[model samples]
Target: MTTVPTSAPQRATAPPSEGGHRRRRSRRTRERPNWVAGLTSVVWLAIVIVPIYWIVITSFKTQSNYYAENPFAPPGEPTIANYRLVIESDFPQYFLNSVIATIGAVIPAVLVSFMAAYAIVRGRRSRLLRWTNSLFLMGLAIPLQATVIPIYLIIIQLGLYDTLLALILPSIAFAIPLSVLVLSNFIRDVPKELFDSMRIDGATERGMLWRLAFPLTRPAVVTVTVYNALQIWNGFLLPLILTQSPDKRTLPLALWSFQGQYSINVPAVLASVVLTTLPILILYVVGRRQLLSGLTVGFGK
Candidate 1:
């Protein structure tokens, strides 16, 4: 009685943009799965994981069990006999040799490459340094296989063959090229203002290099170290051609002990394989983040 019938309130409608967004989202929801990517990843994972699974399973089995059972089957009665065989067969000697060679190569390669990269980045105005950088790039094109003969000859001439030094020297040489490439790119991305400020604080070029370049490029250093360590650790060809004595054998060569012309100890061989790969696995797990960060640092630039 006091008022006329209240007018019906209008419901608010979504704007065109919001309506379009919902439609687009619905279309996206209907899109097909990325089968190619998923399939490719599955295939690649199988390729990597199958071998690792075989190796691990074989390592736990006895030699007779390995032959009697399906190759892919898990060990029904896992034993440490294969590992014991590996230990008894001079595996420790071989492991020591590998450690020596890897450390010897990686330390020198990283250090020398870091200095060279620092020079290349900071010495851009010098024509000689530019040419030197080109030379390092050229080194990348020279395959290790092509240089094998030369390296063998050089090692022979230097009286370094049949020694861990033979393995280390060539590993360092080959490792430096890639290390310099990675590190120089990282060094180039460092802020120029930091260098200027260091100079203003009476820092010598060398001082600035050690204090600034070294610290900043640590991730790259870790990357290079891990990369080179893996290379040296897994190196079969180098050890094969360079070393001769059984006592001086690296892990790769020592694996041959599990094989004979007429008979083979498959489980023992796989035990050795597992042992050889463990150190590298540990190294990667420990430094994975640094390695990835270092590798990606220059990509954004």
Candidate 2:
């Protein structure tokens, strides 16, 4: 009875060889350098940030110091003199002109494009819709340069040259095609069931668009609006060709005033450049989140 006690055999463990293999594999992965990808990213950032740094630094320097001193060096005495001069000059008028033109151009462009896009998406099977969409797409290919001469002549005939309306009208006309394209693509993705449900509830086309589709398509709308704002806000060529008076000038033209016929005031010119770019920078910063979200929502779905 005392000799009956016994134990089962234990399972054998793997040798240290398997453990060493796993450790070596992990160590190899850890040792692999991602230097090339990291270096490329750093270089790209430097390329973008350097110019912005130079502009901001140059804006603080005196006119003589800008050219005489090393461009890379910081100013000895950073001054607001240039900004004061710019503000006291006709810059405010030019800023107002720019605001007027940009707003006027963007609002109508967005509204008209939204309607066109909705129609294109809803009426995709119709021949007339196909023709209309093709025409809108063609508008994108036509260069503004080709139309400038005719546009200028027409502006003169309408006696709208040197006025904000002239700038707004032309910009709206050109911006619509791209806006339509962006919005139409987003509209096409909206669930047809939503539209059917609205129809069953006795909703009209306008009601469905306003109550349902418009709300759903907000991201695409935001992206298009921001895009148009950037275009209209920074436009130089159209304003240059259309308007002449200093008072009628937009920011780009106003900035040109700092460059004289004989010698360019480099510092002042750079200052103006900084001033002109600030609005756009601010706009991007403020709307960037919404813009990014919109783009993601529109494309990711």
Candidate 3:
């Protein structure tokens, strides 16, 4: 019997209509941009940028036109006289003072905070470490206003009053707690295996910190540094109370002086404000990527 060659059963295929339905379903499920979120972002951007726009425009206007006309109006004839005045005045000295104080404060604050945070995170558990951490956190709770009088008296007793050192020291002390908190969180995210490996290789605690932790924690370091820099640079009350001499003044204090007891030079004052903001703006522009990365990395973990 020549039997018909047995053939393998064919698997059934889905109809073309079924495939098309899946594609259509996927297309329908695609996400759309959120219009409400976009609108809110635009509104926030305008709120931030409008003042900057007004400041820049006011900086270019003549003193008389600055006050007489609407602030939002475009300049009829832009001039650099305000900047020129700022440059020729004690503004440069105050700017230099601010730069010095910011740098001095940031360096020590970053270094000390890093070490303290590393110790807190990695050292043996003890009441001392706990107490220290609590104290650091407490620093955040004590407003600068409450301590201003005590700080002033202390500065005078130390003969640091009227000196940039007075401003630098206090700012560092005030900034340390927040810096420690940020750095400690970042440091804690570092892998335990790395530390163990370093130890197995005979790395000292200091060596491990410098080699393993510092490089890993750079983003947090930059964030803390920038934060401290901004605080010291823009600080007013401490400088105002500590330093009495105009030559010893900081940018914020100098800006305050631009407004006389009897009259104010709004244009000159705004120009000074613009100048005062430039260094910080430049810093943010340059370090924004690091700052953002650090924030995300520190917070995400």
How do the predictions measure up, each by TM-score?
0.87, 0.85, 0.88
Cα lDDT of model 1 by residue, 78-104, tens digit: 999888877887789999999998899
| TM-score, prediction 3 | 0.88
C-alpha lDDT (0 to 100) for residue 263 of candidate 2: 42
Candidate closest to the true structure, highest lDDT = 3
- What lDDT does the true structure give each of the candidates? 0.88, 0.88, 0.89
> How much is the lDDT of residue 290 in candidate 1?
92
Clashing pairs in 1: none
Residue 113 of model 1: what lDDT? 97
Candidate 1 ranges beyond 4 A from true positions: 1-33, 261-263, 298-301
Model 2 ranges with Cα > 4 A deviation? 1-33, 261-264, 297-301
Arrange candidates by TM-score, descending: 3, 1, 2
Q: Write the per-residue lDDT of candidate 2 for residues 210-300, one digit (tens) a residue.
A: 8988988887888899999998888889999999888888987777666662145567677777888889889889888778977787455
User: What's the C-alpha lDDT at position 267 in model 2?
Assistant: 70
Better of 1 and 3 by lDDT: 3
